[model samples]
Target: MSGGGSWRFECKFCNTKYVGAHNRVVSHLLKDGGKGVKVCPKVTPQQLANMSKLLNDCKERVKNAAPKSVPLPSSLRNAATSSLDYDMSFTCSNPTSSEVGLKKRKGMGTALEKAFQNNSKEQCDGEIARMFYIGGLSFNLARNPHYRRSYVRASNIPGYVLPGYNALRTTLLQKERKNIELHLQPIKDSWKAKGVSICSDGWSDPQRRPIINLIVANTNGPMMLRAVNSQGEVKSGEMIAELIIECIKEVGHENVVQIITDNASNCVKAGALISAKYHVIFWTPCVVHTLNLVVKNICAPSLQTRNNDDVYDACKWIRPLADDVSLIKNFIMNHGMRLVMFTEHCNLKLLTVASTRFASTLVMFKSLRK
Candidate 1:
C-alpha cells in the first residue's frame, strides 16, 4: 500500500512494487529507481544497465538539440539595448528585468547612471529647462502634448522667466500704439478717392485705462489702428476731436468722408470735426449702439416721470416676481414651446434692429429660456 506514506505501484511484467515521493515517478523511471517496480526482482544487472543507457541516450539528444535563434544586426542589437536601458531607467521598469542578489553586483555600474552622474549640474538643469521650454512651445503651436504636460512645460523653470504670452502681447500692443502715429504718413496723391469713412471706438482695459482705436477707410481698404490720448482728465469732446483729426490727416483732408462712431457724446464731437473741416457729413450713431439704447429706454422706469422713486419701485416689483427661480422654472416647463417662439420673435426684432449681432446668440437665448 504505502512506504513512508507514498503510494506504491507494481510492475505488470515483474510484479514488483515500489514506493517513492510525489512527482518522482518520471525521474525515478529514468534513473535506476524504476528497477524496484520491475516484474522480475532477480533481473540481470546487464539488462538494468541497458535500460539506463537508453534513457541516458534520449536525454543527450534533447540537451544537444539546437534552439531557434532570432537573427538581428549588430548595430540594431546595440541600439535596442541602449533603448531598453533608457526605458528601464527613465520610462519604465519591468519586474522580470530587475537585477537580483548581491553576488553579481560587485562594482557592476549602470551605463545610464554613470552618464547621468558624469553630466554637470548646470548642464542638467539647462537641459531640463530647454526641454520644458520646447515642450511648452510645441504644445501651444501644435497642441500635441496633453493639457498637464503643456502646463508642466510652460511653468517649469528659468526658461519661462517671462510672465506669459498674454503679458508679452499687452507689452507689444503698448509699444505699437506709441509708434503708430508716426506710421500714419499720408499716401502720396491719394486725395482723388472721394470721401473716406472712419470707424472709431473707445475700449477700456482690465485696469479701466481707456484706449481709443481709430480706423480709417481710405482709398485703400483699411488703415492702421491709431490710439487716442487717455492720460489726463477724460474729456469726451477732446478725445473724439483728436481721433477724428488723426484719421483725417492719415487720409487726406480733401478725401475725408463721414466718420462713424457709437452714440457716445465724445464720438459725436469727434464726428462733427470732419463735417466742419472738409464738409463731410456726420451720420447717426452706430446701429448696434442705437439698438442697445432703444432696449435700455424701453426698460427704463424713468419713462413714468417719478424718476428714481418709480425705478426703485419697479425693480422691487420685478425682482420678486419675475426673478423667482421656482416660478421661472415652472413657466419654462409648462410653456417652453411658447417661450421659444416668443424668444425667436424677439431675436428677429433685435436682428432687424442691429443686423450685426450673431444669430447664434439668439438661438442660445431661446434655449436658455427652456
Candidate 2:
C-alpha cells in the first residue's frame, strides 16, 4: 500500500491494496472485487456513506471552479437583442386585433395568423424576380395570366410586382449582354501579345444537323470564337481548312501560335493545309484523342484468329466482356425497374460508355467490376 508516493487504500480483512484514483478505491469498497474475493466486513454503512459524500463534494467543487466564459462585446450583444425585437415588431403590429378575434372565436385563431408578416414585400418580390431571371426560367412564364395570379396569391401579400416579359426580353437582357461584352474586351486584348491556340470540333445534333464549334485558348482562358451550322454541306478537308483559316483571320494570324484538332483523316488534312498556309503557326492532333485511339487499338480483338489457337482466342475475351458491360449498362439505364433493382442490389450507379472516346469503355468496365 505504501510502495508508491500516491495514496492507496487497503482492504483491512484481506489486506489487498488498490492504488490510483478515488473511483478505484470506491469500487474496491462497494464490490470487494465481486465473487473473486471475499467482502471486507470492516467497510461499514457509515464509512461508505462518508466516502460517497466526499466524492460528490469534490465533483461539485470542480464544476464550480471552472473559468467562466467571457461575455460578448456590448455592441454585438445589443445588436443581437435588437434583431429579436425587430422580428417581434413585424409580427405583432396589431396585437389588439388578434386578441379580439381570439375572444370571439374562442381559441380558434385564423390560419393567416401563422403566415410570415413582413413590411418589405416589395424588396422580397424584387429578389424573387431577380432569382427567376438568374435561374433561366422561360420569359413567357411571366406573361401567363394564370401563373402571374398564382404567384401573387402564394405570396399572400398585396402589390407584389413581377418582372414583365417585354421588359426582361428587350431591356434587361440587352444590358446584361452589353456588360458581359465589356468584361470580355480586356480578356481578348490580353491574349494578343501572348498568342493563342485554336481548337475546333464538329458534331451532329440528334436531328443529324452538323455543327462545328471553334474555340481560342490563351493564357487567360478558352473562349468560344464561333459555332456554325454546316447546313448539310460537305465537310471535306478543304472545307474544314477554310473554316480554320477564317477563324485564324478573325483572331489575327500574328496572334495565333497553334491549331489542334482530332485525329480524323479530314481534320489531319485540314491541319496540314492550315500549317502550309500559315508558316508561323504549328498544327497538332489532340493529345487526349490520340491517347484514346491507342487504348481502342489495344483492346480490339485479333481479326485473323485461326481455329485451335488458344492464345488468340484468349486475347479475344476482352472484347466480349467490354460488350457485355455496355449491354448491361444500356439495359439498366433504358428500363426504370431494372435500374432501381440494380441500384438496390449492387449499390453502384452504372456509367455509360462514350462513343467518341475509347477511354470511356475502360472506365465503364472498371466501375462495373467495382
Identify the candidate with maximal lDDT.
2
lDDT to native, each model? 0.54, 0.74
Deviation of model 2 at 75, angstroms: 40
Task: Report the Cα lDDT for candidate 1.
Answer: 0.54
The best candidate by TM-score is 2
- Model 2, which residues run further than 4 Å from truth? 1-115, 118-163, 204-208, 301-316, 327-340
lDDT of 2 by residue, 1-370 (tens): 4546656667674688656555556566765464334445577798778867887898899999997533221211122255333222323335455445653565323455335322245335545565677689887877989877877686796767756999899898999989988988876897778899999998887888889999999889888888889986888899999999999999899999999999899998999899999999989899988888767754664554544377566567777888888887888899999888888889767888777866777888889989
Pairs that collide, model 1: 13-39, 14-39, 14-40, 15-39, 196-257
Q: How far out, in Å, is residue 40 in model 2? A: 99
Per-residue lDDT of model 1, residues 1-370, tens digit only: 7767787766544565567653344334433454343234545578667766876797789887856332221111122255332211221122223232221343323576457553233344445455667567553543555555855776676566635688768986788776764555453234355456777777777777877787766565567457665756576676577767776776666666577788877677766765676665554578777876554443333445356675556544432433353355456546969668757765532112123333333333344454
Cα error of candidate 2 at position 256, Å: 0.5
Model 1, stretches more than 4 Å misplaced? 1-194, 218-221, 281-283, 299-367
